[model samples]
Target: MKVTAWNDGKKTYGIRVGIRNRDRFFNKSWRNIEVDIEGSIYQFKLTPGFWKHCPEFRDSVKPTIREWLEKYNLVGWPKRKPPRFELVQIDNNKFRLEKYKISL
Candidate 1:
């Protein structure tokens, strides 16, 4: 997933789940999820709707993005250039996100 900043520059942000992985949660219903960013736990409710083809963690998910950026030291990077994190599914409701830095 990628980090998103609001178009109006209102300091709003969200984590947009990729379409390829959205199908992992096939229930198509609102479900509670606990995401582990580093060691912090962020809680979010998976939105339920047929129109929402791509699952997004908005509103209450701002902290997740902030913590992720801070944890990964990507705070001052250019716009739309943050690396995508790997979201690992631990179970039906638990997930872990991590960004691996490549060393050349």
Candidate 2:
């Protein structure tokens, strides 16, 4: 598993997670999970079709996602609501969700 921070211009923006090695459940290509962070909260969107392929998506990935968020100092920001997430999957035993706009 690999975690990468993405930036636009001078500010750190979001993260992309990539995983190699196909698990027993999924095979074909690598997998990626994306997270968009705004202030101290993050969000991931999931669709029904993705759930069909991997029912354990949230169970398998949420902890790692939290770890990555903390590692980047992107968690626990003062916000009106807590962070939100959705379940999704990719080819690798890994998964990635995507896209967010950040304020400087």
Candidate 3:
């Protein structure tokens, strides 16, 4: 997966994820959501008055690409892994990245 950031011209910024193979079976697209980036750590903030949902990222997000690495004990960014089946599940789940075999 890849993460990209775009500033909103003030101190605000939003993030749209490039999930390798996210079926999106349980979540919506990560568009228009504010995200904070600190090196390998990624954070998400929900605007006030908006209904919070998502069991994984309901209120806010403090996700790290490292966590995913820890979960799978893999090395390198989108590389060095023998294979990630979950990512495949995501590919089958989502239709955005039909060709997601790239190196960073």
| Winner by lDDT | 1
| lDDT string, candidate 3, 41-60, tens digits | 23344333222322222223
Q: Residue 20, candidate 1: how far off, in angstroms?
A: 1.8
Alpha carbon RMSD to native, model 3? 11.6
Best by TM-score: 1
lDDT of 3 at 40: 30
RMSD of each: 4.2, 12.8, 11.6
Compared to the true structure, candidate 1 yields what TM-score?
A: 0.65
For 2-98, candidate 1 gives per-residue lDDT tens digits of 3232121444345556555676553455476787877877877766642266455643636667655655565554665545556677777677766
lDDT by residue (tens digit), candidate 2, 1-104: 33333332232233322233213334444243333333333333332433344222231334545565456565654443223332234433334443223221
**TM of each candidate vs. truth:** 0.65, 0.26, 0.24
Cα lDDT computed for each candidate against the true fold: 0.56, 0.37, 0.30
Ten contiguous residues minimizing lDDT sum, candidate 2: 16-25
